[model samples]
Target: MHDAASALNPQALAEAAGAAMYARDTASQSLGMKLIEIRPGYARMTMPVRADMLNGHLTCHGGFIFALADSAFAFACNSHNLNTVGAGCTIDYLAPGRQDDLLTAEAVEQALAGKTGIYDVTVKNQDGRLIATFRGKSHRVSGEVAPVQR
Candidate 1:
């Protein structure tokens, strides 16, 4: 069960099913985000900054970077097909990202306590240099699937 794919919880969620898939799917049209990988309690995704994503400083917006890691965080937290919600999160930007650069976000769960889980997300550039780091807390809601959008 520790196999890479198994560790990613692939059997529990198809590449096109569930909340992770949905978030990643919606990200394509909405956020222009692309999910790269998913393993048990882990997830990775990437995005190309658009002109609109730039901030007053003309680089990728800080909120956009946070969104990148947050998406991965949500995916990792819900890989078990359980409904979950973000209870809180904090992020630190170590560097800025540009519109022409490819940004990668990676999230890994740090701890789990029945219905509560903690995750750490890191964002890096194509060269693998750190751009940002995030810590997130999630609460597993009682349900067979992730929360539905009404």
Candidate 2:
């Protein structure tokens, strides 16, 4: 398994990871998250702020924004073809998200050491307004994301 993994190129690994993860990700699909781009240690995703996702203040709920960021982080950390899971995460809201807004989240890996990694996701609106920033720590477990050629 390790030899098969090591034999795959970086881009091949990322593509396989994305395909495998998307096939099993129901929550992201159910929430209407659109995957824009993915590569090794990076991912971009978009979500529309729907009316059903609004809070009492008539703005998009913080939870929905956090979810979008989290999904982006998950994809970024897992792009290495490892079965990685989030160990911890944090988000800070900068601006209120409104209904009908197209929010895009871009996540990038900050550090990877041993079995742990750190990622940062920036959530922004279509108008380029920052909505939130998220940080996620990931832990890679013992599994391959997909079969690879040795």
Candidate 3:
């Protein structure tokens, strides 16, 4: 399964991967998440904390923040076009996200071995306040993101 799709250069692979995933990512799109940056084993995305995203406490719900982090993790782990899925993940909230705030999540690969990998995601608000920290474990499945020269 170590094919050209997996062997593509970092930038090219990131482009291809994002193109493939973004086309089918209705969840991220519907949430108004935007891809800011992407590279091999790395991705950054932003989501706006809309009024509807606020909870009873008048802060953005943790689930929305988690989704932003998870989305970044998904992109980072799948940057190689290896078709990865989350095996497990955990997130810690550090600060509250307020309405009208733009939240950005950046994910970076921490390690990779065999079919499993680890990624760390940091969520922040527009004011440079840390909102959450997330760790994701990924399992690669058999597939190609797009056609690639051998």
Candidate 4:
């Protein structure tokens, strides 16, 4: 028997998977992160820098920025509806994020093979100034992110 979900296009499948993941992502939601866009092997998220997220130096904490990028990475890797997790990741901060700055992270898949994939994420401020670059390696686990549906 043919499954109805098998007829869904890649874009539809990705959107469904993203919605399912975002609904359960309490960390991202608590941090005011928004899933702006999602597609096969791509995702974009935004987070606003709040005063409470600032460091002693009066700038947004590096951890918060990293979290934004990581969330984007996660969404992008999982867009295929396959349960994927970050096997490793690295980030380089080029500039500090200030309070009230809206930061956007865009993650793009660089390569995918077998059960592994590489993703590159760029975090920028509202003014489009590059703040940081992140690279993540993803390993696909053994499950679907969401049940296939029509």
In model 3, which regions exceed 4 Å deviation?
1-7
User: C-alpha displacement of 150 in model 1, angstroms?
Assistant: 27
Off by over 4 Å in 1: 1-11, 14-20, 23-28, 146-150
Q: How many backbone collisions does model 2 have?
A: 0
Candidate 4 lDDT tens digits, 24-114: 9999999999999999999999999999999999999999999999999999999999999999999999999999999999999999999
Q: Pick the winner on lDDT between candidates 1 and 3.
A: 3
Per-model C-alpha RMSD = 5.5, 2.6, 3.0, 2.3
Report the error of model 1 at residue 24, Å: 7.9
Candidate 2 clashes between residue pairs 3 or more apart in a chain or in different chains: none
Clashing pairs in 1: 7-40, 8-39, 8-40
lDDT of each residue in 91-131, candidate 1, tens digit only:
99999898778889988989989899999999998888799
Q: Which residue ranges in model 4 land beyond 4 Å of their true spot?
A: 1-7
Each prediction's Cα lDDT score?
Answer: 0.78, 0.92, 0.92, 0.95
TM-score of each: 0.82, 0.94, 0.93, 0.95
Report the poorest 10 consecutive residues by lDDT, candidate 1: 11-20
Is 1 or 3 the stronger prediction by TM-score?
Answer: 3
Give lDDT tens digits, candidate 3, residues 46-127: 9999999999999999999999999999999999888999999999999999999999999999999999999999999998
Candidate with best lDDT: 4
The RMSD (Cα, Å) of candidate 2 is 2.6
